[model samples]
Target chain A: MNITSAPPTTDRRIDVALPGAAGQTEAVAWLEGAQAQIAGRAVWSEVRLEIGAGEFTAILGPNGSGKTTLLRVLLGELPLAAGRASVLGRDPGAAKGQIGYLPQRRHFDAGIRIRGVDLVRLGLDGARWGLPIRALGRDRVREAIELVCASEYATRPIGRLSGGEQQRLLIAQALVTDPRVLILDEPLDSLDLPNQTAVSALLARICKQQGVTVLLVAHDVNPLLSYLDRVVYFGAGRAAVGTPREVITAGTLSRLYGVRIEVLTTADGRLFVAGLPEAPAHHSGRHEHDEQ
Target chain B: MSSSALPLAGLSLDPVSDFQQLTAFPFMVNALEAGTAVAIMAGVVGWFMVLRRESFAGHTLSLMAFPGATGALLIGLPAAAGYFVFCGASALVIGLGSSGVRRHRGEESALTGVVQALGLACGFVFLSLYQGVLAGYENLLFGDFLGITRGQVLTLAIVAVLALCGFALVGRPLLFASVDETVARARGVPVRGLALAFLLVLGLAVAATAQITGVLLVFALLVAPAATAQQITCRIGASLVLSVILGVAITWAGLALAYFYSEPVGFYITTVAFTIYVIARVTRAVIDHSTLLRRRPEIAEAHA
Candidate 1:
């Protein structure tokens, strides 16, 4: 494939009559009552959440909460016992090629020292196995490398790069397929301040510039406050979804944890929710939401 | 004692006679063909074995074939075919019998352990039943490759060809999934199917290696070359290619040295492969230091 950094077609008109277009901007999910249990313990009970198309949504939760489990169900990696769910108007697993996913903190084996652009090429060309020797038509591969700003490191081994560089490489690998929806699990976990800002701005640009919907799962919603379009708080076997401002409020926060939660907003109009039951000890300083 | 009657120990032998002893005899040729074929198959499959961290699976399959080979010998059938059959069966069990890897509670080695135990135990039971029924039990521990037949050689060739095809067919996906499963799956690659297929290919390779190297020496063929190659190369494609080249070179080189030195083939191969891998590791470290010293200016320029 010819990998390039060129912007997408100006027309953005895909005349191939792709599926799920009729349902554009519609809620991808309509769960009346969804539940998941493990060893007779309910992780999620009577929970309902709607994921809209073309929306940059963030799923926020505590460490042991069902945010990840919910994402697994959404990605069709796990099955729900009593629930109806759909992605892109089809079963989540069936809409496989249409979504891009980045797992949390996965370290590639040091044995392989592939370049960043080659990793991106894999997504663009699908997979090549058991076939005659053929490169991905060269040009597409170059184009994909460019699209992700990974061409500079196209020849550098991934292991030699820094952690933030590796994360960027992974993001490029995840997005090279031109997927409709991109899902990242804790993309900001180990990034430095500069990298956190860089990646957040990058994702924001891709969403606004390319119309690619984003779903980010993060435990620390503190970093994502300024850039996210909406927030979905998963807690106590349920979830609360609305605009970040509306959902991170005192009433929503207190109900989510079954304890008093105070949201402090600085003069800059950025909000941070703290005083939850899980971390009462770290309740001294008000968290700054716009620092990164 | 007469010179011929002296113990044939601590002495080098005539290289040509030793070569004849290894191949001119009918049984010796059988071993040569089998050994060569197994070495090639192991080289290719070993690439994936290293990638998947399924070296234990190779060991387990080698052990799992014990009963099948002995049972075949006890019934006066070809043990080579039996080994291949049993290895394939063990692979199938390992791939499909266990629940999904995600269900294994936060333990990476736990699933590997369970699969290893199942295969080892089943192999032990099979060997126990056929104990003392074969000509020599020690030969199984340290293979007597000279006992292999022409039919087995042909069979190994076919197996190697199939494995080569399998590797090439799934080379892209296998590498993709091993390096990054989430990205591969999102891009519509069949991660689970590729994993299962890899296990099966590994089983086949393990079976072939066990027949010549003995179950104990399968590690030498599967791990040593690939591990060595990894130390020397940062490129995935180059690493795999070099691993196979090194594996085949070690096998042939070891065989030649064994003939000249009258050494046991397995021990000779292992020693040579280990030495090469160690040297490669040391050389890579030195090269890294030198590159850093020399390329500082280039790094500064690139950043600018």
Candidate 2:
């Protein structure tokens, strides 16, 4: 401890870094040529990937591509059988609360009858069972509602809400604790265009303003191009990680998916990649807004 | 209706004087007192029942006690104590056996189904064995509430205190866990322990009421008032308080009515509670519809 001198300012501001942020932990993930076991059997081998801090990397691959499995490893929900996976410069298990996880799909306990505000309150501290919840508290609940811009239906029971409304409520719940790293698995499900815009905008704000590190699992990159800092393409039993502009080349796209691929910018200037081995597009130039 | 006015009553089993039945006898007072006390615990536990979506568990618990009660009779032990032991043990077993919420099977529902079957099986077995040896025990099965004594009422008072203390201690975590077990577990709560504690409390309560109303009729005191309160209210604290009031009234009113009739006491208690539940349900629906209608004016003005 240091004894302070007499110099004083009228006001002082202190900055706090977010979780999985710059300088808090070395943002480097190192993996050797190790096999990933699935269902007690080794389906793939010799996988290696490195992810650095402050990187918004979208992991993309074909269906059944193990992208979701890879997210689980990063969240420590699954054990890496042959390879070691590290998160926030430590084992993933050590940082569960520190990391925010949004799964591809989750069923809300329909029996849990509560308003959107109370659901978000569960995120703040009620997620844990032992602690008491004063869901009626004024300011904190208000702040959470405002943070998510979920004030409109804050008092609306979740059972009466639409899919987009529920999605926002889920995101608000995820953000209630202000986690350091936000990892989302296909968060764009059932979202409308406006909601998608609102969510992406909010995520970008969280990343930039709060410095929260984000790892998004998405099939397409159009909605995410502006928000993502990098792309991690996984295929043929390996992963390649770098910037979207660097990773979205025709060669990289074809190599990642193993098919004839085309990357096109829409008339609205949205970056879209069209490639799939099966389920050929009816039109060569079909507008497949992946999440919109 | 005469007290041995007909001489054939001398050959009958344990005939009672007609005058002994008309007044507020000591045993009748004890029955009403014990019934009301146990009903308080029922209200509180039943709040959790509605919250946790385990009203079915309430029915299953009453049934589960049947085997334990009958088995106690076979072994020549106090059926109430046996119920406590069996139901408590069943609670712990259910806890250890159940693999938390996320499961391929609905373990609680499955366990309840099994318990119901076992209860019926044991009831039949005990009935065969007890054809003549357990004439009064049949009355105990549905409860001759007029037969309740001061000792049982005192026991009910003690249990009411313990149940209240348990409620105060775990009230918050209990609601949180009931609301969402998976999320609560992730939040570092001992979710399984909370679940077990709640189940044990539930067992203890059902056992207490079973003394006055029997395992067969405990549901009237255990579930009816609480469930009726649920229909009219959403706030848990208010619902709990209302349920207790409703429970006490049901039993007290049933006791008063039993004073005037020759019916089984459980029958009156259950009928009163069920009637209250139906009335509350209907009234609540009408009130809610009226409130929506009342809100239509504001909605129209806002649109304008």
Candidate 3:
């Protein structure tokens, strides 16, 4: 068989047909009464949220509050037990390259030998099944690397890079598709302060430059406060959707926590929620601290 | 003279004439041809097998050859047919069994162990039921290349080409899934299908390598070269090329040593392969230690 004769069979076109197209600005994501049950009990009930195109929104919640489950529902990996969800005016999974996703932080094994650029290239056509004839999307891969400021170490093995550098490459991987919506899960979990700020700024730049809607999940919100246009904060089977100032206020958060929570803004404009429960027992001594 | 008493250790000192003598026989030529085909296929598949940390699955697939040969003897069919059928069937079994917990961790190994145990037990049962003496048993366990036929060499060549092509077709996506399954699945990559496809390709590679190296010694061809190459370099393309080169070099050396010293080829192959891997590991450790030492000045400057 001629290995390079055929284009990759996995290069199928996404079904992007919208249901209605009259004077409607297609939302990047929409969910109303989205419910997820665990052990026959709904962790998320009647959750309603709409993410406008090009909006940068943060999904915040304590553990077991279905923040990840919400992202999964948006990715169409999990079906809503109740209510409806749509992404780009179609089912979330209908389009292949419309949503760029950055999964939670995962460190590669030292033995994994893939380079930073190769990881970005995989996002280009990693699912396709054939030998690439002629350097397919070579320029696009280079552009994605440059976009993330990872060109200096683009050829370095992914395992050798620091956590922040690796996360940047992963962002480049997600951006390679030029997706309409970007969904990141806990992208800033282990980053130092500077790297977290840099990644936050980079993501803001991405949203503005490409008009890509961004849904970022994080434990802490202080680093993201400057860039967040909106927030969808879920807690205890309920969700609140509004601007950062509206959703992160003491009254809204105290009601969500079922306990008094103080949302304090320091003089430098960093917000930190105090008097929430302590870190969970399992997470007592870990490097990762729980969100308030 | 006992073959064990032959001067194998001394042959290395005067290797040029020994090498020429190894090429003197027609059987040696056929053996080399088969080894070359087997080496290339094993090298490519083994790189993925190691990368995916599916070496246990690979080992189990190689062992499927045992029952395959015994079953073939019972059914009056060629042993090669048994090897492919058994390996392919086991691949499906392992794939389906591991599907439940692709992300669960530790579950796949338990299932693989069960399948491997079942396969080995079946092999023994088949050997016991055979009415006639199971001749060539030693040859099946510790391979002999002295009687390799031209037809066998051609079969090896075809299987190698097919396996390599299949690997090439899925290599990019396979690496993507293998490295990061969660992100790949999120990006619309078929993570589960890729896993199953990789297992099937691995089965084919195991079947081909089993013919030349025997079931027990298959890892000498499949794991050692790839593992050694990985220890030496952290580049995908370079590691792959290095693995193929290492595989071929060791196979040729093993065949020549087995020919000159009159030993089982598996012994020479496994020994040499293990030695190379150990050398690579030592070299990596040394380089890492020195790099840490070299960075001490930078740490001191930062402190200042």
Candidate 4:
């Protein structure tokens, strides 16, 4: 098993570098020969990638393709079995709270007694022990809420808000930390088309404005295509990375899946892939703007 | 109705003087003091329990009271020591048994049920084997608030302070984890450690409250106030404060009603708590319905 791939070894980095600007274009998250272990067996192995700072990347994979496990590794919650994974140019576990994360949609119980702002405030100092002096943390929390456009429902019960509204609040929670890298797992799942687009655009804006790297895991790539700068598609314990147009092509995805897969493009430039065995099961019945 | 036939029963009907006469007894004063301490501890800890959806664990800890008392009688130790030992031990059993990644509700529930059953069996076994009359069975099961001694009240106060201070130490992180464990874990909150610490605090609360309301009716104090307050408000600080106030009110009023009616204090306490919870739920529903009714007109106008 390869333990650590040589540093300064990446296919994704810009080959040309300015003498004084090395830090600006460095890869925020780098994985080389990474193998993710589940139950002592490698579920995904030999993954190599470099995610640049301020880049918007989408992680696309079928169910059980280790997409979530890969995110967990970057969050430092999971250890790689036989590779090096560096986050923000340091050991991932040592960089706690430096990476803001939005997990999949989680609905609170109906009787949940918390305001939307409180949820975001937890993102700021929720881990701190004792009663939070809201006076000290309120300003930062307010800025986060404003950033996500969630001020209108900031005072409402979190469980009472609509799905789209709740997602915005969750994004605010993720942004409250002013993290260097944002890791989101299916942030747009169960959302309507408009909400999906709006959240994706907001995330892209944050990335551009703050120079923060974003690694988002999603089942489908259609909603995120417009804002995504690159794509990491995982299949059968293998990984591929490139621009969306490059990775989602019939030639690339078909070879990745070891099956015939069709990449369908609509008149409006939206891309969809079909003919994979799991495509039928993966298609959500919700109305989409285009069909594959 | 039979109370009317008693010669002195009619005198108990005056609400003001009846309250005064009840507090006139020294034992009643002690009972009130102990009840107040127990109510405060329960209200604070129970709010977190409900938020974490750990009511089953709370119930299991309360059930330990039965074995604690019976085993104390069997081994010649103080019942208070037995209560703390059994409760603290059971908390570890529940916490350690199910403390893993988030989303293991099935295994956690199974562990709670198993612990509760074994604890109840031990209580029954201790009761059968002890040769002396296990005289406090009624007290153990239903409680005798009026029989509380000064020492018991002091003990209750000390336990209340300890539990509340412990809560003060971990309250924020615990709240964050309870509301959203995934985000809390992602942000480096000690989610698993917080779960274990909360279970221990909940153990202290169950041990304290079981003395006042008994093992069977512990939920009367542990769950009712928090549930009622949550129904009325979604703000954490206000809801927690409201839960504490509601808890104290229910205990005090239950004590008074039990005095006037010559009934079991547990019965009055549970009934009053449930009644208040019902009122809060109904009021919340009515408010929601009215808001919906008011919104329909505006929605229609916008469509027009």
Estimate every model's Cα lDDT from 0 to 1.
Answer: 0.69, 0.67, 0.81, 0.81
> Model 1: chain B TM-score vs. truth?
0.81
Fraction of true inter-chain Cα contacts (below 8 Å) kept per model?
A: 0.65, 0.19, 0.71, 0.87
Per-residue C-alpha lDDT of model 2 across residues A190-222, encoded as one tens digit per residue: 677777777777777777777778788877676
TM-score of chain B of each: 0.81, 0.84, 0.92, 0.91
**TM-scores, each model vs. reference:** 0.77, 0.77, 0.86, 0.88
Native-referenced DockQ of model 4:
0.64
Model 4, CA-based lDDT:
0.81
Steric collisions counted per model = 26, 2, 0, 0
Q: What is the per-residue lDDT of model 1 for residues B118-224, given as tens digits with 9 covering 90 to 100?
A: 76676666667764656646556555554567777888889899888877778888888776776676566787787778888888888888776676677788888
- Chain A TM-score, cand. 4: 0.86
Ordered list by lDDT, greatest first: 4, 3, 1, 2
Q: Which stretches of candidate 3 lie over 4 Å from their true place?
A: A1-26, A33-41, A255-260, A274-292, B1-20, B100-102, B292-304
Model 2's DockQ? 0.19
User: Candidate 3: deviation at residue B107, Å?
Assistant: 0.9
User: Model 4, range A220-287, lDDT digits (tens) per residue?
Assistant: 78778777778888875677777777678888888876678888887666777787545423322211
Candidate 4 colliding pairs? none
lDDT of 3 by residue, A1-292 (tens): 2212222322111112223223123667877667775555566776667777888889997776678888888888877778878888888677546889898998887667778888888888887878755387889999988988999888877877888899999999998988998999999999999999999999999998989899999889988987888888876567877677767778888887567988877766677878765543322222122212
Q: Which candidate number maximizes TM-score? A: 4
Sort the predicted structures by DockQ, highest score first. 4, 3, 1, 2
Cα lDDT tens digits for candidate 2, B1-304: 2122222222223224433452335756677678779878888887787667766767777776777777778778877777888778777666666664745238777876777777779767975775457646656667666556677788789988998888877776676667656556655667778877888888888888787777789888887887787677655556778989988888776665555555666778989999988998799768755655665688656656
